[model samples]
Target: MTSRGPIVGRGRSVSRRTFLASAGVTVAAAAGMRGGPLAHAADAVPPQLTVAVIGDGRTGVWASLRAGAGGRNLEQDLGTRIIWQPGFTASLPVMEAVKAGAVDFTFATATAVVNAVPARVPIVPLAAYPLPADEVDFLVQANSAIRTAADLKGKKIAHQNGTTGTYSLIKYLESAGLRLSDVQAVSLSGADAFTAFAQGSIDGWIHWQPATALALTKLGDKARLLSDVKTYDYAFYVARGEVAVNYPQVLAKFMKIIRETQAYIFAHPAESVALWASQGGFPPNGTEQAVYEKLVRDARLSESTAVALKPVDEAAAASTQDLADNFHALGVLPNKVDVRSFLLGAQFDAAKQAVALALGA
Candidate 1:
């Protein structure tokens, strides 16, 4: 493996010699794409795997960094270069990428995977990352009269449409005995939701870290956390079915690298926060650090690869089915499809075990 230490920065310098060598090829041979073992190997190697990512602030940052950093580590471990794709903005776009065969892997909330699978694009969950429900804060201006969930009745709540935030908002409100019909739902992106909340256009907004922390800091005493989705474990790493099947070993190597990085992050929290902030282009105001700490504090990074596909996993599957049923009931999906088939099967389990072994779990 090439011995250059972790390359930092968005545009770090990398020589062709280093690239070829890291990819396990002779420099002269790789340069010529014909009539040689190097040429055949290069041709056989799949094009850089394109991983879709959501552009929703912190999760987006995490997805990009993890994939890039993890890919780099795997490149060194496997002596093969891995291509990292620029992430997309929303689950819809990511799903589109999967359908178009542009994205080979992705990390997103289970809710996103649920919705994508029915479209006939197989998405398999590899591992779970536990996110404390309180991490996602539902807020309103403190001076506003919306002091209780009851107060939100007939009021507008801003959230990203078709996201975990949207589901959590509905679930929380319903738990308070307020139905969707009782409150007005304002659909907006995370950034837009922040703006709407700031402009007094929306009574409440549901948001995840970094943005949640930023809103609290900016709105100060004016904004207060009204409700937190207390049991929400929102995200998971996933890969397209074709990629998972054809490159199981490669995928296993990828997951092993992620597990290692997660351990590194936990062991070196300060350094991890700094690296995340620097790579994510967060300003040096320490707000990013605060948010990173908050996420890391409540988050349980998976050390083992055979993640339990339990109630939450089932709920995620059910949620997707419910969404599809609702959409079909509302004339969305053209035909009824068995969404469960798209989930990870036995092969995935084998791959997980392989990764676990690699990680020394």
Candidate 2:
């Protein structure tokens, strides 16, 4: 396997040298198009993989990858096309589309994924991405008396019930020796929660980053965070279970592309964020858009080093199962979910191996 070192790289493309150089790693024979053996498993590549995009789904890097991140077109490298289904409000809604086959893959929370299993959503986790615990905070009107989690008692707090936001809220309440019942927990989409909070419909919003960046920027002194929260949140790359079983090669290449992209981001945070803004990553470029961008950059890069994509494994299953059990215990979930049934670690072993071989690990 590549050295268990931090991802590091630079320049316009994330070619193999970037991996061996700054990342302190070596790679397999660079004998194919663009000096990458990404297409070794091309024969197994399907026509297209429909992806759910909240904000281009890291296309800033994927675009560069598709256009030739390593001196070759990644479409030719991976032998597939990406069909993005954009404007998803959140992962819970994305899971709905996944069930109807309108979407094939998405990055959702373990909370969302676990909830999917019980809802009969035909999706399983492809890999795990540990989320930054500090990315979420409680946003309340600045004039409100709620300065601490304890002050939130009896207040209406908006959180996306089945996603990481809810998990964070539950954890936050516990820190204050309280329960969900202690607060009027309102389940709402991110957008709605923001609107409602702005209009004073909700007492507080358990805001997530990027949106949190924007909320703080727009609300200015009108809103202040109740307190900083550290959450045990994780994001999962979930796909239709059949896809992982049938197209190991494609999934493997997808993982490689993401790893390379992550390296490139680490190497060129500015360029990556610039591309993000240009690609409508942070839209509306309002007068304060730059301010929002800066805040989001701090939020993202602060913990970007922790981003790693690996096949869902036993430890991952147990970790998420505990979170699932928490929801069930809180009475938010109808029944306990066996995270193993939906994480697909066993079924994804072949794809994981394919990824290892491609990276010359």
Candidate 3:
């Protein structure tokens, strides 16, 4: 049943009732013949693992495609199906899923994980994609007279409250010698942020690609790149630490498929862009192409799965730490927690190694 390579789109259906019934029969048969506790424990292991995913944006779409593709490969390699649960909004919701035992794996940002760790949710990083600073942009209506970062003072701006968008805005404002208090922060998701910017409800919008590109196109001549926050790592894949430990082989196969897909993307940028566009439901008028080029040129996809905490990553970690610290100083985080210990873990290193080896890096 070995697959030739990773599958690259939405997964086929395997009804839960059917899968559970089969699993019950297999477990019963294994238990009847088991010779020891270890054997019994092995016999009790589930036949499939469930992974939760957020909505159908680029990240979610890519994740779903890779997981489905990878799961097929893994089923051949490990004799099991990887179930997926889709339609999540943010990492916080993913964290909620992990906490409730509804999902075994998902992706999130380092900062979000840090915020979650101190709450004792037990998650760990699986892999990282280092996004260079210029990959994310702060944008305003192109026709607006807001020429510099300083001009944002007293202006309303839209941003997702607890995401890279927020941090990017904070850093952009601070660098311009302005505090968040200097500008009105209008909290909005990437989608809503785009809408707000278009309606002129917000003078500026800070967001990542796809959404940024979409907004710019929607605004036509009304949108312009304000500041590119060239100092953040956009996102990372993560799993509940215990789930990863309990299912190393499953995680390994998943990483292998992701590595393959990443290689495919690098080798076939145009095709990859098309795939992203299709998955994300973007229009074919070159919007996806524009965003893909901007991101591909600036974002560094790992060539190897060596999730070593690179200096830049560490610096990003420190910057996030600083953000948390500032939040505490400003009474944002309810109670202060050790930001370092809250986010640091070894799962990323293991996942990195698995991906690197799979890709022959």
Candidate 4:
């Protein structure tokens, strides 16, 4: 019998369901009856890397590089094309996508990496960029009585649970000899938490950059940061383990491009800020861009010019291990995790050396 496949166009939705169900199988079958990064054939043409992009914050890498000359000529330079998948909203979703072999690369936070360690997600950390310490803060309403971290006791604070915000709150409280249970912790998404805090429902909001930047820009003097950047975490450029093991040149080329781009931005701060102003995903134009311009002018961002590929280095691992221990104490993480074991291996070491060579280091 000649079959033109199932007539899925009709109202018989079951046929449509059956047809859709075979789509994954069809894709796998087409790819030699295998799926994900591990299935790449040795002689296959260089794969198009599916990169995940987050919208809200910590967007410096994906957003800036995409719009810069650093990202141009990727196919010619790296032998790979990029398929940008934006709107993940959070790094967790991106990490999950990488685990499921849906994404090839993006920046994931150190906290996110620590969390992933226990979940057994297949990820390879290529480089670690410490979150700009000065760019983050714990913010309070200008008129609020809470003048310091110590004042946060028994106060209503809004934070996204199991995120950097929670880490900020915990560490700040610990510095003041306080604990998580001492305050009224309200768990909400970043946007919602900001709204509640701004509306006076919550006493404070603790979070990383762009959120802190947004509050300062929109609220002006009406918003006050409790202190300078409180806790520390790294923004990691990570990839699927298979990508690191199989086609490491792509990842190596990526790190090289990142180093080159950072140098370019450092050399042309004004031009870089101008580009950021024009981009939609970056800190908004006018005031927000003005904030960055001011920072660049003051040379505040100077030290971060040189980027490094860290394969579970001592300092980073120690800090991440402590972070994991603290998150466990807060009852957010079910178990204490060792950040070192999952992040280092022979595959990553080779990737790092390849990246270093690409950077001419």
Candidate 5:
């Protein structure tokens, strides 16, 4: 279970029910027989642990990482069985589910974490990785009159509601000394926004990820990126505060495994692209590979000096506060809330130690 090594499971299966049922013995009998049938039966099955995931329309990379250890099953090489519960499609729902105790853990952007605070989601950042700002951008159709952020004034722009993309769009406007009211803002899902832009229904589009890649590549000469926003965004690994308290060891192991996968992605960018394309219903092409590479490179995982379950330092606290302040200033939130109060510092410390011991860090 070393981070630098491959995790290959033993492929062993045992039934706890059958073992317990067959080990018919009274407490006195078991006490007398230290290495008897009961003791042997207890070693047969590994413990199973479950966590929730919000698949981002593509790339179940988290699940894929677990499967790479052996097969695409719940069992892991760390002597734990991982049962993945995936369904919530976006960050907001993931936060809500965590708060409601529907799932133990999930992932989201730092922006989503900021928004979650006022929504009363009781979740905290366990770990974090940065994403290149270029993953999101303000785009205009080719041959359009819009050439810069300033040109967006009074133009119809499409962005998803309650997403980090909205924040990106607002930042783009702010850079141009414009506010949301300076232009006609249209709220639409990424899919719908793409269609609207393609059909000339909206003047421009604001979004991230494969959506941005799709628009730029699929549209070919028809889509022009007006600006890129890599410096202001983040990707976060988050979990319920309660889960961190109750299962700090589990969180530690989980973070270690994920860090291993993140390493794999950096090592094999082209192959990672193919895997994500297959999972997300895209063709394996050079365009797709390039997109995935930039997204992964922007993460700078290979360049990160952070350990698993990194504590929230002043810089981390400031990042969350910036998101909160930006959102509030833009009227996305009613008021700016102090995000550090929700951070689980002690829990992260325990998880970090657990990972170091379990993985021989």
Candidate 6:
């Protein structure tokens, strides 16, 4: 594995690197593409993977990887085509699509993954990206009298009803000896929540980074950080259980691509920020740069550390299980679910090994 360190921005540029070791392999390698040794076979053709992606531009790094620097097109080098199904900005809706098998894979919030299990979604977690506690928080008007979570009682709090934001808000309130009932929980999308807060329709808005950045930028002195929350918030990759069982190599290759892309992002911070800004519809200025830096800090992974892939570890599983427990108690989940049934760590490990051997990496 490459020994690239954590990706920090010092206003430096790095050359692009190919994700594949050799581009010489022929299309006949598809037989071995099912997580086995790459060997020649008859009647083989390249496979296409359909990925449901976020439309909000937060995941534009994946696009940069696919398109490559100077239009290198790494997906062609890997002998695969990616059909990107977009129009999603939040994890809850994305999870619903994946649960219905509308797409092959997606990266969803851990809260959505946990909630899906009880809803009988046949999905398995492939890997987890732990986010820093401050990535999500409560925002209030800069001049609002509500100074703490306690001040939220009897006041309107806005959040995307079934997202990690809501879960984080619940955790934040609980830590302050408050419950969901204490506040008038208003279910609103991130944009709507921001609008409501701006109009003083909502006392506070609980949301994630880029949205928070936009709010602070537009509202300026009107927006204030009322609560900085830290929770077991994770952005996790999940695939339909059938895919993990029957086509492990596809998932492994996808993981390898993401790992490589993550390393590249770390190596070229400025370029990455620009790419993300262009893709996510943010201005490539000091404000967006600051948010990107905060995202990197909260991600807390070096390039070397980012390459390690496990299906789901104990801590992640426990955190997700705890989410399920809390949601069940809060009457969010109709029935309790044993999260272990949906995790396929051992299988994912074998698949990764098989992919390494097949790719000769």
Q: Find the candidate with the highest TM-score and give its number.
A: 4
Higher-lDDT candidate among 2 and 5?
2
Error of 5 at 144 (Å): 1.8
Each candidate's TM vs. the true structure? 0.72, 0.78, 0.73, 0.80, 0.75, 0.77
Residues 175-229, model 5: lDDT tens digits: 8899888889988887899999989889998887766776777888888887445
Residue 4 shift from truth in candidate 4, angstroms: 43
Model 1, 1-361: lDDT tens per residue? Answer: 1122321212354443443333234445443433332322211334456656455323323443454543444455644555556546666677667666677777666456656655555555555554445556788888888776778888989877666666666667767887666788877887899999989989898866556777788788878887545434345666665444335456666666665665555555555666666665465447766766555654522221113322124455454556555444433345664544433333244334545455555
Two-way TM-score contest, 1 vs 2, winner:
2
Candidate 2 — worst ten consecutive residues by lDDT sum? Answer: 1-10
* lDDT tens digits by residue: candidate 6, 1-361: 1112211112332211111101112223322445564322111223666678776434445556654743446567555677778779777777778766677677777777877765656565667656555667688878889897778888888988767788888888887899888899988987888888889988888887667766787788888887556545566776655444345556666666776677676666667667766665466776866666555544532122344444456777777777777777777777887765445333244333434543345
lDDT against the true structure, per candidate, is 0.56, 0.65, 0.57, 0.65, 0.61, 0.63
Q: Tens digit of lDDT per residue, candidate 4, span 1-361?
A: 0012332222332231232122222323233323543233222334588888776323354545677454466556667678888878677778788767788788777778877777767676777655556645788889989987788889988887777677777878888899999999988877887778778898888776556666778777788877644657666777776455455566777787776666666666667777776675355666777777666554344124235444345576667777888888878889978776545433245555556566665
Off by over 4 Å in 1: 1-47, 56-72, 231-234, 298-341, 344-361
* Model 2 stretches with alpha carbons more than 4 Å out: 1-42, 55-72, 283-306, 340-345, 356-361
Pairs that clash in candidate 3: 7-69, 54-88, 133-230, 133-231, 141-222, 142-222, 142-223, 305-352, 305-356
Ten consecutive residues with minimal summed lDDT in candidate 1? 1-10
TM-score of candidate 3 versus the correct structure, residues matched by position: 0.73
Q: Alpha carbon lDDT of residue 50, candidate 5?
A: 50
Better of 5 and 6 by lDDT: 6
Judged by lDDT relative to the true structure, which candidate is superior, 4 or 5? Answer: 4
Ranking by TM-score: 4, 2, 6, 5, 3, 1
